[model samples]
Target chain A: MTDRYKYMEDLLNRFFSGETSNEEERELYRFFAGEDIPAHLRRYKPVFSYFESGLEKELNLLTGEPAEAAEPFRRAMPKRRIRIAAGMAALALILSVAALLFLRKANAFDPYEGSYIVRSGVRITDTSLIRPEIEATIQKALQQEERANRLLLSLSASNPETRIEQIQRRINRQNEEIINRFPNEMKESIRRIIENK
Target chain B: MKTRHLIAAAILLITGSLSANLPAQETLKALVKKCESMDNVNTSVVRNRNKQTKKLEKEIISLNFSNNQALVNEFIAAFEKDKLMADKEIEGKNNGKKTLFYRFGDTSYSFSQLNEGSASVSVIQKDEYEYEE
Candidate 1:
């Protein structure tokens, strides 16, 4: 640990440059691990031990050479760790892509047609149910028509001069009923009259 | 001799009146038959009539219970179709003895249903607006 700072700088400079391959790096670490190393370099030994972690395991698996290096070797430790890390990264990438696709589909909407629409007093929708209020309204209309018709009939009985007025009144009331009952037909007839003129 | 002549004259008068106008009344049934069978009269086209119930031919736009029937029909059949039914009715106001129809509309008119009798204009969807006439 004495001259550890100077040796570490030298090793670091050599480490960063393209000068040391994995074998050379391991040899440097082994040299630092030796007990007889100068006190100056002993403190620097721990830094180079990091090199032992990455090197011989994967290379020994490929070359079939590490079996003789240690008698009770656990075998190719670094290669297994690298494989496990790579598999985890791949799985995470697949899940992220799947989640992104699911979110995009969930937000998509159909823009072509529409559902029910309500406007002003009239509300229209898919279901066919008539309201009680509408029935009451229709009843009021019928009552009015009945009164108008009765008035015109009585007036007709009273005098002959008002016959045309009576005819017009009767026609008007009938017209209302016709339009109310069968609007489409009545409308067509009126249109015909106008066009003829 | 005078009694016999009176009876004959009455019969002749009835026959003349019947001959003069009976065809008009009969024409509606014929038109109905024609409409029922004719491929040109599409029920699907009139199905878009909201709040209005309709039975129309190619040229007609029947306004229906929704209070637009008379106006719709008159606008379409009378103006557009140029065909007339002898018996036609419209919802209108009482002016003196005549019930004058003020519900006038042209092709540009809006056929809409509202709570009050106010119509909001809309650009009809394509293919939704069909006129055989």
Candidate 2:
């Protein structure tokens, strides 16, 4: 075959392999439609004839538009449909994934659970429950003070010097009781001070 | 031995009942009445002035016999005889300034004397926790 025919056959092969552009395909169609065709490539006549008939039908469908001009619109229709379907599928997948995550987070939540704290870090759940307990403690302190007062007054009623001893004892007792009843952190510090002393 | 125990229990019950029947404020009221009878003393009562969680009665009796040691002694004697007793006492002196402080049952009494022989006594009663507003 001549070099030009060989080149045309190569282009036709490339077009069948979908490696040719629109302009290149147009060149291939014009070459195949020409009557000056070689003998060995004659077997490709039916295939080229089919392409010509398809182009004519497309021209008719496009209302007298050129076959080359109508080719892009025909090719773009299927591409646009595929793009729309792919976009819808992607949106559906995203929505389902978001819904699954939201459901998982909701199931992990517990509404009734709560925390309890007192002052700073001492956890005491019900304040009403702790109120009576604290009040009872203050009452005991009051009673202790009352008892000491009564003893001191009676002793001082007869002799004032007796108050000195009673006063010291009562003071010591009060200090001990208060230190014992103090919070853990305060009691620890107080103990450290006493030990150091 | 069981009959003796029962008799001892009966005696305790009777004494307890008798004591409970006696008015709790009898001694304090007598002391207050005696202090009120003293001349040259002004007595004033304040109720619920603090507006805190508890309402208390504060009995203030100002003595005009400030420099009289005899009157002070009498007053101290009367105070010691009352139901309330002083649980604490603080004394300090600096530069001819003298101060005395006494704390009783939710009550406090302080007496201070300056260098010029001017003396003043103040009594304060702390409120107990109350439920009502």
Going through the candidates in order, their DockQ values are 0.05, 0.01
For model 1, chain A alone compared with the true chain A gives a TM-score of 0.25
lDDT of 2 by residue, A1-197 (tens): 49989898888889889999888877877877888889888888778787768757776777975666777999999999999999999999999999999999766442212212233223454534554444443343345445535655675676666557767655443433334444667776554443333
Please tell me which predicted candidate would have the highest TM-score against the true structure: 2
Off by over 4 Å in 2: A1-197, B1-32, B50-64, B79-85, B91-100, B112-119, B129-133
After best superposition, candidate 2 residue B42: deviation in angstroms? 3.7
Worst 10 residues of 1 chain A by lDDT: A109-118
TM-scores for the candidates? 0.21, 0.27
Query: Can you give the lDDT of residue A166 in candidate 2?
Result: 68
On residues A5-99, what C-alpha lDDT tens digit does candidate 1 reach at each position?
55655765787686777776766777766776766556667666644654456677689876348544545676778899999999999999999
List candidate 1 stretches off by more than 4 Å. Answer: A1-75, A110-197, B1-133
Clashes of 1: 17
